[model samples]
Target: MLELRPNCECCDRDLPPQSAEARICTYECTFCASCAETVFAGVCPNCGGNFVPRPIRPENKLLKDPASTKRQLRSAPCGARTAA
Candidate 1:
């Protein structure tokens, strides 16, 4: 199951469970659309994989499988885009 991380790993922007702004890599490293597009250039910093929009769990399903409240942030700001 997707962790559906609560915030952008790069910019620490809030990304709620249903946020369309959330993007994730295959490894599920989450980021906001801005960071994923502009900062990382669609490439994941932690992994070399490309990013895609994170699936939003249905509201009812969220009650059974809760969206992760545990926030993750990068140790440092994602500065430069890495080569894909």
Candidate 2:
């Protein structure tokens, strides 16, 4: 199951469970679409993998499988440390 991370790791932007702007990598590293497109150029900074839109967990299902509240806010831009 997707962790449905609550915010952008790069910019600390709020990304609710249903946000269409959330992009994620296979490792589930989450970023906002802006960051994914502009900063990382569709590549995941943490994993060197391409990003895809994060799926929205249905509201009803979210009750049982809650979106993660643990925000992975970063102090520096993710693109600065691109995966080797």
Model 1 misplaced regions, further than 4 Å: 80-84
lDDT of each: 0.88, 0.87
**Residues 1-84 of candidate 2: C-alpha lDDT, one tens digit per residue:** 999999888877889999999999999999999889998898887889999999888899999999999989666656554421
Find the 10 residues in a row with the least total lDDT in model 1.
Answer: 75-84
Number of backbone clashes in candidate 2: 0
Clash pairs, candidate 1, are none
TM-score each candidate: 0.90, 0.88
Cα RMSDs, all models: 4.7, 4.8
Candidate 1 per-residue C-alpha lDDT over 1-84 given as tens digits, one digit per residue, 9 for 90 to 100:
998999888777889999999999999999999999998899898988999999999999999999999988788669643322
Worst 10-residue lDDT window, candidate 2: 75-84
The C-alpha stretches of model 2 lying farther than 4 A from their native spots are: 79-84
Give candidate 2's root-mean-square deviation (CA, Å). Answer: 4.8
